[model samples]
Target chain A: MSITQISVFVESRPGHLTRTLEAFAEAGIQVRGFCAGDTGEYGIVRFIVDRPDAAMALLAERGAAARTSEVLCARLDDRPGALARAMVACAQAGINIVYCYSLAATCIALSVKDIASAEAALADADIDLVDQAELARVLAGATL
Target chain B: MGTPMPAPDQIDFSALPIYLPEVECTSRERIRAIQLAKLIEQVGYTYARVPWYRDQMDALGVTPADIRTLDDVRKLPFTDKSALRETFPFGMFAVPMDEIVEMHASSGTTGKPIVVGYTAADMDVWSECIARLAQMAGVTAADRVQMAFGYGMFTGGFGLHYGIQRIGGMMIPAGAGNTERHIQMIEDYGTTTLIATPSYAMHICEVGEKLGFDWASSTLERGLFGGEPCPPRLKAEIEARMHITCTDNYGLTEVMGPGVSGECLAHRDQQHIAEDHFLWEVVDPATGEPVAEGEMGELVLTPLDKRGIPVLRYRTHDLTRVTTEPCACGRTLARMQKVRSRCDDMLIIRGTNVFPSQVEDVIGRIDELTPHYRIVVDNEGGLDRMTVEVEIKPEAFSDSFEEMSAFAREVAGKLRNVLLVTPVVRLVEPGGIERTLGKAKHVDDRRR
Candidate 1:
């Protein structure tokens, strides 16, 4: 089972975020990882939730354009150049990084180019990479 | 060889005093004759000074030597509004930027608006011409005049504002907005005459009647109106309701301002184009040749005395005709008929191009639209379809859509005869169309 992150388009307004949160609450969906960003007039809300399909339906009912994008989470060594080697490995395999976010002190998340070949490239590099099935099972098993 | 200079005929030239500048000479003959000499000198000066006019004059084989009289004025090429935009901001001004005292412009193209500068003397010319126009309307030093045109980069405001001061009349430069405040000022200041677009005057009158202000009872005696054309009926209604005589004033920012030509106290619908300071010629719009006497054509004016940005035979695009017939106002300036339409205002539906004025004339006379209407254009299957939306009072909206459709079709039929196109009528509930305080904008072209 692949875990897909849902990104919803929302107009910037007072109480818009609260109203959207209520929609998720009504559907009994717990948002595990969330990113909220404002682009002057509107916000892009991206959520990694327990049930992406049910959450997407709530957004679609409210006339919002929502989409799914593949994302990755990786744990790196605390030492410097540990992530640099991973980047170099991806570069050697002709993989480009679209976006990367700092997950924690020892964990970095990434949205990359070519999910399939890049997944093979990560496996070939002997790097410990968390796949979608593992992330979805962990999210489903979480006590929220 | 210098072509024989034709003497300016004895046409009534005072019909348009606003476009003219004050030369030292007073009479039209002296002014026209002075203009001729200046015309010769200007041809030489511009030919030497300005590069574009030189090229145009050069192409025509017209030199300073060829210009002898007002008749020789034809030797110079006619410039139009597009050329001013081509020149861009102050590129067209003959004088240096330092000499210009003020600048104004209409809406811009692409970015910042296209600008026009007035020399200190240009301001004086503008003001004096308007003052002369006010005097023609029986405005005096004792009379309090209320001006209701919008102020800003718009020319109508400052044009009339300065002219009232130049004419030495007590002027209340009440720029547009706040109709109630305008009425209050009229009452407090004992405003005798008013300057505004005719539709605004009608609106003010309507409001006053509702508020029980008795604007009709007030001493507000006369109105100088333009910006948008006021049909014969609305002109009559405003005059009667506001209890003031209404005079039509016409001009555009492209030429100068609203004081181009104004009706004098004689109540003549025709405005006398001031030929002495500005040479007026009517040309057949299609061929770009001078129309015969009594024939309707586009009015093109050449400023003889305008410095800084003097124009020669600038096409105004206003359709009009000249009659040598005498005006009772006693000014000998030629009488120009009411501007029928601008060449650009004509709209093409399917294949036939139509002007809003054709529908407007009939719409104004009918009690249906009550003077507020909109013209919306859309394209379908490569054909332009126009809908004339009428904002009749809600009481006028019959319960039946069939009756409404029939009513609209009747108006469409009337427009078909005049414009050769059938436009569907859309009967709007009262207050459906927005009332524009400035120019009444009706055309919405959504065609690809």
Candidate 2:
């Protein structure tokens, strides 16, 4: 019920972001979604890529500090309050949302405190969650 | 599965005849004669080949013939790091480029690095010298030596590389970084000896703690540590943590990587200089005059048999004293005290030498970073951790977390590139770091 998310520690500089993107581009890795947070000196560049392992290998080959973690993605109808409902379901289940981001209007990726509880909560709420296979298909440019 | 590790006291190094017993155990008079002859030949070769040496000798009004006795070495002008820097890429090379089969360099205060070359013969001498030091430190053919020093332009890696090979030990050339991999190798390969900077060795211990990898339980018996000084307290702490005795080594890139001197396993107090190949002197840093024996002073060395870039009376800037008293190990080679400090602003972190000015230069290149920065060095579980706290330009201050983190990583990466060491780069608000009047304090060393 989750996809592998690779997070790289990138120094916050002018060319760092550019170089990282260029590295991904050169490796021909497609990024489905990404969210970044900066703490002045460095930034965490997180990516949801088609080939997470390949993307990580490319970053490692480039000597970029990176790591992979599991993040949950839910497929919702293209409408407002869809994320709010999913988040409310997780909040009701006592699953805290660490961070959340969305690429298309219908797909929302969220990192939660408890993966199993969040998945159970989403399942009980009749919300369709994308597994690794569905996420891979989406990352491969397939319509959800 | 692996051989039993030996206790520090149980490691019998004295019983093993010293490497190169003929040279190491030679009489003081005979050693002096060898030094005098090699000094004469090397000085003449330097003056004839290296234009910088010839010009310096001419300016000092001293010729190669002036070096008749070992005392006459004082007549020649002392070569400092500045002299080496001024020569740049290849000016100080006594041998032609073709003859120099290998080259290594260390970071200078500025952008230009101090380049050192080694001929095939020089490489042999380097290996032999390192092998002698290694053997003195109690490494043997049965031991599997894991070298953690980075293998590249830096001399520390290759110095240990050839030396371990000369000793006929199984070498796992595990270059620097990836502490996890190093620990895995130790567990998988049954590594007996570890060669790394004392700081790096400490860092590996920290990694072991995080992964719950018991280094004390590992097959690592002894460590040959150099590239920086290891104090008694630190040495003891490392020995306690890893259950191994660490012998501190001393060397310079200009002289010949890490073969200059090392401590015998029998005595962990002082490093024995390879007197047969290099002549050492402890002198006043200011006056460049020789200090009394056993007195703390700057180290000066002249390569007696070095051919590629023969360094004559080269001031090492490393502050230490030389003692000629016989060691219990039975080697007659003179022992130099452990180096605690330098005569300059250079700082050694995890075996990589770094200068504040070099770091400042890198910071200055970034538009978002202000020139104000403070380097704080701390010893966390015997590992040296450097944190560079710098203020960001007010105009560049961003509320977005992405911008801030991206900037920090960039600075850290650039620093890792130039310094060959990764420092925790912390960005503060403008004017966060204090300003000083006279000589701005760039480094706050809290390791002690």
TM-score of 2: 0.58
TM-score (0 to 1) for chain A, all models?
Answer: 0.71, 0.92
Off by over 4 Å in 2: A1-144, B1-13, B344-448
**Candidate 2 lDDT by residue in tens digits, B274-313:** 9989998888776787889987678999989889888888
Number of clashing pairs per prediction, in order: 12, 22
Write down the TM-score of every candidate.
0.57, 0.58
Worst 10-residue lDDT window for candidate 2 chain B reads B1-10
lDDT of 2: 0.81
lDDT of each: 0.70, 0.81
Q: List model 2 lDDT by residue over A1-144, tens digit each.
A: 788888775556777677778888877877788888875666667887778888878876765556687888898866788778898899898888878887544677888768888899998888888977877665465321
Off by over 4 Å in 1: A1-144, B1-32, B109-112, B345-448
